[model samples]
Target: MAPTCPSEVQERKILRRSRFGCRNCKLRKLKCDEGKPRCKRCSSFRVLCNFMPNVPDLQPVTDDSSSTFVVQGRAQLQPPLTSAVWTSDASTFYQLDAKCQDFVTRYLGRSLITPDDPNMIKVNRKLLILAFTHPFLMHASLAVALAYDRHLNSSLGCRRTVEECYHRSQSTTLFNRRLGEPIETRDKDTIWGTAAALVILAFSAPDARTPEESWPLKSSDPSDFEWLRMSRGKMSLWSIANPLRQGSLFRAMESTFAEIHSPLPEKGIDGIMRPLATLCHLKDSSTPGNNPYFNAAHAVSQIQDLLDSQVKVGQTELFMRSLHGPFESLLRGKDPVALLLLYLWYRKAGRSIWWIELRARVECPSICSYLRLYHKGYAAVHAFLPGGSLAM
Candidate 1:
């Protein structure tokens, strides 16, 4: 075979110069304008600009694990930005695959998970960047992203998809190891971020479709309220991570922390409905630390405040916090008052938190059935619940 220069002297199509742009520009496969200070595309998109002025020559990064140097085909990341597809084999820097890009970009652009706060998104964007550096965090993030995607697209069921399960398992293994080993200050945020992600994964999925099969209604098991336990368990990492400390990426979330750690009122009956107060046996002396029913009753009342104020975010965590200590024991012991308060909380909280509805829809009705069957005397509280006829 003889190599020829050309059969008929053909003209070369001159391609546009790109390649040496900022991370965001390179990520979208756009021909970088190579603008100083900030790139036009990133500015127009309102995304973070990681551009450097008078950049040095591109050298292979010491850590390919978190590098955005890999070329993921635009086909995998949708909305059709380019007519040309990247040559798949040209990208040798592996690990950050097309799916990861698809998920993160879609998540940031769409505001899929935490939609309310721009500040929250900024913190999460930083967390996501950190996720690329930590394998466990990456797994945890993907697990949550997949769970939320399933929640949005798939039909109602508590079961997680296989991808969700695999990520969750992998993250758990590595997360524990990171905690056990002495961690650097930089690693602290990664631990906290992964912990938060894993908690969301746990809360997002439940294993039952019926209240009879759900916790408290179902036969008592050691794993009852395991999701609640896992979420609360993350508080142990608070001092370790010190997320609220200055210079921490999560310091932007101090408002969120305040919302979470709002002190319990001195009197549990402060805002409780008379019926619920009586049901919980709330007295002038009742406090969360003293009376067992006080916390559960207080939690139920707070839901009304949320409704009255038209507040949605952070209420799910508030309800679960009530389930700790005496309230949890009472719930596991199947105390009538605890079950009644829980049913009321579910009825109110279901409307706001998307994932809570999955458990609440089944559990609310089941609580009604359980009450009717076991605690017939409490049927009078039915007036408080919207669908009280079933309990009656």
Candidate 2:
């Protein structure tokens, strides 16, 4: 027998760089941006933006978890539909089974926006219209709604279900694809909406079932406490989207964002707890640039003020946003001192923020466990936590 040649041994599959690119870009011989609503080049060139992912009308399926739930009990994502329509405005298209379609239509808006705030009603409707037009936004909304549903309805602290992860993966793919392209003015709110939803998802869903498996007490990885990084990333979108700018529908969230983002005092930690102050090593001489803990310290101080005022609002993103890299790294690296500071903040934040109470259910206890197990000598610092002696 002749020796087989390497070329004959294996046949390579040739790949097309523009596999999902729009026809106009392929015609113009340019790489398509592959974003939704319209690709950047098509939007700039002012032509019909058409491509293929064409979904044949999905024959309406009966109500069943077979299509909507996990393929197995594992957290594996559902495979996407292969074909889609030529003229649809969204990025990816697939049929939601009857149960999912109904859930999204009925409970999704309420899961996201508070009905108590009359202003949020308009925000909810506006987002629904945008979600219809932008598939990435739609998936992001679904992921959030599903997670919020589980949070509200679960009898115990439950792990994220596979269905939630599927929409999250889909939204992440399309959202990142759009972020890479030349951002058109019209796509700003859509982009912002998706970013905001993902931020909520990040905060609300962690993989662990109990505090022992949560951050600090749990093992560390590059992605641990991802909510902190996500909060920072969403803030960067503000310059691009400028939700408060005239004619932007997202301006409806302005009061909510503004409420949590009240400026730090001109010069002190007046509202901050003395125990937290000492834990942070804050001094009259200390300023943000000089002390790594300064910003985290300042943030908790503001939270203290909010709690004292009996403000009913709650978006604890303030803790993540106000942190500088040094302090954030300390938290990510699972430093006891850093975890102690966070414990203090978490205890205070949970008092008023019902949503944060869900996270504190795991993390706050984990911090106490970690301190009790490893840093027993730091009795003074650990005292700030629940069951610890040092009261704030």
Candidate 3:
């Protein structure tokens, strides 16, 4: 070829030697200004400010992407390396479903109830107990909805429906009388369950003005009040179980998650175990048919099984706060199911802790309610039965 122009010759020389583009521009695939010290693209991007020398005077920067590099063979950079950044934009509900299948499965029977079905009623009653007494589930939107939905299928319909029942029950002032007429009138188990359910409903009252107060009745066993002493110590049953034993514990734990279906920290439930233990005491000691303390202890021990193989932190907290009032009553020695009723009342009132505790303290007073009821029941037994004194 004829003599090439100097500028054209230089351009050909640089372009011919390069593979894709300049090193800095190739990583980002951007246009290079080809400035001295650093290319304009690299400088604008705030990348490393370095120039590739035409001749090898100084060693090229070491490829220490994996290893730490020492400056002057003495010290290393404080942080190691810069990796690629990641980003995503996805649907929350989709992510929630993907992550929280286990939580959804726990309330399957309760949440999927059909009206006019006996099984549905039983499931609703059980779920009501769980929702009314579960502190963690009560606090979360998803958990509460899941547990409450189960109740809806059994007898109630939805959040709005439950609120309507709460209001209607308020007008009756028999907020605890779901089986008010006692259809069969003679099944002890049914009677006991109804009594328990009514007791729980007392706690479920939405406001002092509506139902007026906590349940007027009290538990008839010392075991119910005894759980408060256990609360003073560390490591409640909720703390001891890795995953927990009862299925109900996981009822409302789906929507309130941090990452997609990620497991929560193991010790997450440890803080609330004492309170839960107290709830078990109230539930167990409602009647005198068995050693309520032992029964309560056994029920609480099963809480470990209630946890999924893996737990989520946010969901656990959600379950705990939702049922805090019932658990707290367990600590203070209220009737288990009755306390659950109080929980429902709080639930109806949007589950306000201040309102629940305030009404409970005003209505139920303290642990003395259960103690007095037990003493009265004990006296009644001795006064009426021939060998009551020797029955123990």
Candidate 4:
């Protein structure tokens, strides 16, 4: 029966639900519209739209006790011209690193020096300039540049046009060449490695999402492994190596060491042993920049793994060769700086016993002497040491 069409009140309630955007968006305080072509808000926002299901048979009854009542309201929505969007391009990205940029700029300016090293002077000056304009952006940009420069010419070395080396390093071929491979036609591994490396170096310090304070230096969580940094992003070394499969970057870094004239290990597989040993050597040296505990541990563990493995002598020598470099640095017997580095690696790897062994091995005058030298610089350059332990 025509049943008076449930009066004007019931019809208004039906129309309201029939018109426009999905119920989810509307419930969430987002704009929406009930429409045929597209909801007004969805169209304006350039987002997809969906409608609530209609149940034709389910009719409203004239029950005075029912909470389901209808109200007639009229409001028109117009599609807007602009909508929000996201893209991979850094320049177009939002102001995420504004704070970090400011801090980096000021830090560089304070440390700016008239070094005899022209490359250092140049990079320092450029860094200063970027600090004032955009520190966070510069950090990433400079890293890319530095990586690229390394890719172009292995002999070019770091501390020069670091930004350029970093940039070019993103190119898989360029990145692979830094490890002594000729730029190749196509290797996705190289490309991924390049990208991963840039991301690690560029974003390692001073970022909001993964703030250093919250992250464990020696986490066993696989999630924390940053392949580019050759350190775990979250997981512990045990868990990281098995599932994360970070052997590639380690291989690349090891190859890079050998390519740069560092001796290869004598035993184990040529691939992993060389890189692991090289990392150990680098960690032991007075290399510039911060050497985080996790990083040092990762390198150390990788070296220990090779030594413990049953491999050919020459292959094993490649790994053992790394010990000589660091050992020599330790044997000078002037200070405990070598011991300190070893200690950090041992501690981070959760090998306190190993730390004790390393500490005991170092000659006193050298250990004590280096400790004093490190103390003076520790306050200033301690940034290289992770976990911010005031004591060296």
Candidate 5:
């Protein structure tokens, strides 16, 4: 047996510098000099460079402690980790399980606006695509999907409370982490998406509260209205991202708000509420001319006008912004009329999940009880009010 010659030794394969090398160089297994317009080798050969675009950077899937597990019948299947690659520095599309992917896809495909406004559909689609590149948005989208899924399944008598809560917790953890960052430094897209996510979270998740903390025994403890505190936080976030008013997400939100704040038709339920509205106005007039109750009623009327308008495109946000003043005044004054107005406002705002969530969290029934205790004669009339009628 003779010793092998150095020239006969096999060369080990090495990773290429550019995955998108020129065709000639790639075919010949030659290193590409990825030059703009054309590589040196391609130039020398007088051939088309034809370099492919670089693929996006994504961390390859790896087994780790955080890997997802699928539970089925008392046994867990450790499916290969299939989730979008989440990196601290940037977001990259990876993969998701079939069920999760289908949910996202369906949400994107659904019509988000009325038939008359086709452009909004395009805008929501863009936002959904943007969600794939932003972690906060991605988490927020997933949270919405989880919440919607849970609600739909519950209606069908399939309870998934534990699983839904677990996923929601994970999604919110990511959402809050991004939300806590300084608003000024974040990009416009991120800020816009954050606002959208916050709205979704407001409706989907329970109001933020101190874990294990019970309801305050004293009403004046300041922590009693944890849900109100959460609402204010959402308002603050929206304020910070106010510049994104031009965006489609904001427009969609405005549309939803408009639908919620639309005036009750004058024929049916309006008749029941008319007397209460009249009494509220009278009470406001009895006070000093600069009554906060009057201000709130005016604000509510403006909201109604915007909702009833034929062209309500940009009015939703404007009305919402204008409303802050009356809302704060009403809360500060602790006026029964203001409280009743708020209850009615929430009742009217039927389209938004946020208002629905707020209605439940704020305990409208408790507010009604407080109103009755504070004001006697009107309370009797309120008691006999028909279902779905506004009570003063």
Candidate 6:
């Protein structure tokens, strides 16, 4: 201990005084002044100075062999107190489930059965990501996936009906609760997401009719029309979300709607449609302007255009596009002319395996009686039936 070096003494004093650094300084691998409110480095960079909360005080360990002692602290530091804190909420936990994540991923990639419009795909992906934070939307999305899976694979040794029903019931209850929430309290993104989820649910869920129940004029099945009504509601909510409408997500959805509902070119369906329009006109000439036939004609023209566009693009998109605007109400009316137009649309839509499966399993048998009653004497209608004149 004779003639101890002054430099060594100074180094030991400096080391003893050093404490843990601020989060920013640690990230930057620099020395921290550990100033209150803001560190020197953070102040210089004009960034928020953040320190770890509830950190255990460091204790210096003495070394018997050497004069220098190492400070012992946590090897891995916690995130800054200012950083976002994630907690376990119902919504967060639901989205974190591997099954739900996988379903959402598959849905975003392959659910629509279309030509893969990047914009539509991007918007759907964003909706699913946003759903993680929104319990209602998360449930709605899960419900749709479950319903679609049940419909497609129920007979293929899939999950039990009881389990599927339980989950769907839960999801539907959550969705309805959100729907009933006061408009002022809910955010616009949540509303839009709910609407989108409803659309998917409409497509995926089975009709409300029992197997033995025959199709009536209105079908009495809520499933047949629930999605349609929900879609209209979705549009209504979308109208209120003015700021959201400016985003690419809204633009993509709008563009898809426009493409789906765009007026049909005259040439594509004029041949088959000319007879139907004439029949509609002959059936009710009293008020030409207000006639369903005229309305049906205009609607069929648009449907034809939709089919032609799908052909050119080499893909068959969702049938919901055909349900937009007046067409939904018209189909619900059970007017023979409107039904005829729908039949033709279904035929064209039948070209897609998706539409074929839907028609054979869900739609055709449900509407069989109504179609037969209306087409009683007409060979044209017979031809369009499941095994009638049409090859489809």
Say which candidate scores most in TM-score: 2
Candidate 1 lDDT over 64-116, as tens digits, reads: 22333232224242322334211122211124446656776676333344566
What local lDDT does model 1 show for residue 261?
81
Q: Please give, for residues 221-249, the per-residue lDDT of candidate 2 as tens digits.
A: 67676777787788888899888889888
Model 5 residue runs over 4 Å out of place are: 1-95, 111-117, 150-186, 204-278, 281-289, 302-334, 351-362, 369-376, 379-392
Better of 1 and 3 by lDDT: 1
Ranking by lDDT: 2, 1, 6, 5, 4, 3
* CA lDDT for candidate 6: 0.48
Count of backbone collisions within predicted model 3: 44
TM-score for each candidate, following the candidate numbering: 0.70, 0.73, 0.20, 0.23, 0.52, 0.57
User: Each candidate's root-mean-square deviation in Å?
Assistant: 19.6, 14.1, 30.7, 23.9, 22.8, 25.0
Tell me the deviation in Å of residue 361 in model 5: 8.8
* Winning model by lDDT: 2
lDDT per residue for candidate 5 within 72-112, as digits (tens), equals: 22334333444443312232222344555676777644433
**Candidate 6 Cα outliers beyond 4 Å, as residue runs:** 1-98, 109-115, 151-168, 179-186, 208-214, 217-224, 242-244, 260-272, 282-288, 305-335, 350-360, 373-375, 386-392
Q: Rank candidates by TM-score, best first.
A: 2, 1, 6, 5, 4, 3
Give the range of the ten consecutive residues with the poorest summed lDDT in model 3: 86-95
lDDT, model 6, position 171: 50
Indicate the residue-level lDDT of 85 in model 3: 17
Candidate 5 positional error at 151, Å = 4.6
1-392 in candidate 3: lDDT tens per residue?
Answer: 02222243222123222353355464333455666666565545444433462311111232332231112112233432334211111100011221123344454234321223454456555544433222112112223333344343533111223222322222122212322434332222222322323322333332222111223332233433221232222123223321122443322332422322333222222322444434334332243233233322332232333433233223223333322343444435545443433332322222222212323333432222332343334343232122333221
Alpha-carbon lDDT, every model: 0.64, 0.66, 0.31, 0.31, 0.45, 0.48
In model 6, the Cα lDDT at residue 86 comes to 19
Q: Which ten residues in a row have the lowest lDDT in candidate 1?
A: 85-94
Query: Tens digit of lDDT per residue, candidate 6, span 194-296?
Result: 6666665554444323222323343354455664676667666655654245453556555455554554333223423455555555332323234534434
